[model samples]
Target chain A: MPGDDGLRSRFPISFRFLDRSRTVAPPGWSRWLVPPAALSVHLAIGQAYAWSVFKPPLESALGLSGTASALPFQLGIVMLGLSAAFGGTLVERNGPRWAMFVSMTCFSSGFLLSALGVATRQYWLVVLGYGFVGGIGLGIGYISPVSTLIKWFPDRPGMATGIAIMGFGGGALIASPWSAAMLESFGAGAGGIATTFLVHGVIYALFMSMGVLLVRVPPDGWLPRGWTPARAAVRPLVTTADVSARNAIRTPQFWCLWVVLCCNVTAGIGILEKAAPMIRDFFAGTATPVAAGAAAGFVALLSLANMTGRIVWSSTSDLIGRKNVYRLYLGAGALLYLAIALAGDASKPLFIVAALGILSFYGGGFATVPAYLKDLFGTYQVGAIHGRLLTAWSTAGVLGPLIVNAVADAQEAAGRSGPALYTTSLYIMIALLVGGFTANELIRPVHPRFHEPAAGAPAAGRPLTTEGRQS
Target chain B: MTTEDPAATGPHPTGETTGETTGRTAGGGRAVLMAVGWTWVGVPFAYGVWELVRKVAQLFAG
Candidate 1:
């Protein structure tokens, strides 16, 4: 309720014109423009993945340990999960324009403020700036375009969401080398890092504003040319019935999907977190072993797989259906993990292919979940629901690395080395994937009781609610 | 059952949903939005893809 006009009133007068609630797309506007708007924000915040580029420099300049230097990025992730959960409803209420603007300001300002922190050598300032303020921007920016995209492309929610989420993964790929080059050019000192932060802030703010100007919500009941709601609803998992974000969370389907995402992500992160070292260990005894540079290359390849999988797999979900697609992700993913576990560097090519497939599913898991949410919960509060669901990711982020790293450490201590170090972790991941597959299999159509009753149909179990909020 | 309701027959059960802007594109505005949209989405996306390709190339080149 506080989000409606209250959120809009918080912004300065000059910015009100950009708010989606007040603005209108000109006559003859194409729905095609919406993805760019969503991408603009995603590409900007996706820089979170590239924070490692700054880590070595920060540790060197500040004389901080690796763990200490990583605080900003870690806290940024924690805050991303927290703020998205808290601010999700507000974003839904205030509209995408408002959310995008807030994200742009907070995200850019986080960089600017972190620059100030670096110039002064105040580590806490960097932590607060990038982690707390910028993290909110990441969370809001992530969800801002999702529901709108789902609305515009009701026929292809998975595909629509995939394009935008792929930007987040790609953002890191672009920013990693770009940020590295900037630091190199400017000199990898405190001054150089500060300058990079400033440039990033200014550039991202400018880039994200494009989305602010270009994005508009589709008019009510608008469908793509030659599309009908009935056709899209034909799938077994899809429902024409809408559920509010608030109530959607109460449903068993939401938690089942939540567990599904958590396990899938946790399983994938096991490999992603240790790609470089794991590859080196697996092939150390080979005639032409994996070198450091090649190990780094292997890591880069995984990133490519991550980005490609988001677009390819999620888009595929649109055709084959979300449930069936996830069946492939978790089902195939488990088998791949099993393959790696059993093969145990017996064949290097087998390890590479299996790992790539796993990473692809990792990225696909992210791009596809929003559509899954839209299927179970209507677009009314899909953004908010998605926000809540991201806690699964946050949970997995910690769980994944912990399980993998912890197991690897234990193996080394026990005098085990090479492929055996990862053997147990791989089996664990397989089990987790199997768990996710079962959860996915358990998903059924949301019962009629949860559906917002149609007006002409007469109010059934639930009241005639629109946009998930009861009028 | 509400599932059989005429209102449920469409995308939104209530028929009139809030924040729905029926964007009608005519000849000129539609063309401009299309060009602008593609360029806007395409540039950054292409750049990202290009960077990724180059990185992978470097990985193999080594």
Candidate 2:
């Protein structure tokens, strides 16, 4: 079933084993197994956040600037969006088994190749390895579990996705300290970096295998026990109609959600990119000012907020509709920014609450958006659609830092001190959130004309096979 | 909800095949297996939270 085309066609030998291994779940087999399967892959790839841990060492050992050292991580994120967007159709047709295998190979090899590069002192090899090769892994791996999890927990798509995505945020927490420890012991040289990269590659390949083995598509008519399509449809703005990935991109709703995601991510990332420095600056004029170490702690607390929000807020979305939850994310996020901006360094507790609240909503935005896609577009090709939507993240990643850093730098040039430095950026974030809120309000059900025809229409919870894939 | 894959095609990575078709209360060995699976995800999160809490405590400790 897996090795039908694309990479599967090229690697028929491996696909043969993987395809048979990833059987659709037999009836009455537990659906609960699916989340862990998804988490296994996400937790491993989520280590991308800890790429910064490699930065200081890489710059020192390789003799490069901060911008040059950041190139591979930046390129990795770029390729992540591109590969997922382009390869989504193949992923849908080939199924999660094939997708996971490709992710594992590319992601693991990226590290191994980086290991070789570090050993050889070739910066380009490191770029090609982690940036080009590993990025594709991030994209494929990120989306691989998404559709499967939604299928399993149709009753709670937001919560199902939250569980997996929370691992992505948590991944950095595990890796940042772990990689720091490794570099400390191994001496942060080219050999040490290579060792770290090699270990990451090997361990991730083994770890992600758990996802490949554990993930399953539902049988053609499977639904959770005591949950039916009718019960799920009672929520507003959700539809039973399916839109193929190709056709989905043609609709206005797709683009609107893209804008919504871009704005929300840009706002949150604007704050996150400058978390340590921003907190320190905000309290610099206060009596009990924040030290550099304390600022790092604030960043850690933001990470916690990010991960906690992914689970807590997204689960809350299951109770309230997807639209309403976004209303809170974008709407309340603006208010939080206002509080942070107007209050300045007047109070420590207010600054902490405002920042933490904003970070939580940022995490909530990522975890909530997929479920929203499921609601608007149906589960058909949702992974693919979600893949395309990740371009929003790439855009925000670049835009967020550019805006925050540029404004902060400009303020510093004018000899501005303290919270005034972030003032303009905070207001810009508020504008971004408000823009995102407006876009979310505009999202509506896809027009039925785009729906797949009756005879060949995919039943809810069934995998969408490409026409050529239907053996 | 469509095809009912039979038990003969048993045991992928999760060794629990459909052959031992226990009643559908979502219990027995499967529940234990579920606990193990959930814990696989939750344990790291617990550690991460513990680490963050320690960091957060520093803001007040000073």
Candidate with best lDDT: 1
Q: Write the per-residue lDDT of candidate 1 for residues A291-318, one digit (tens) a residue.
A: 7877887888899899889989999999
**What DockQ would candidate 1 receive versus the native complex?**
0.21
Across the candidates, what are chain A's individual TM-scores? Answer: 0.96, 0.94
* Cα lDDT for residue A139, candidate 1: 90
Error of 1 at A141 (Å): 0.4
lDDT of 1: 0.83
Off by over 4 Å in 1: A1-12, A455-457, A463-471, B1-26, B58-62
- Candidate 2 per-residue lDDT, tens place, B3-34, comes to 22323233333445444446444346556767
* Residue A392 Cα positional deviation in candidate 2, in Å, after optimal superposition: 0.7
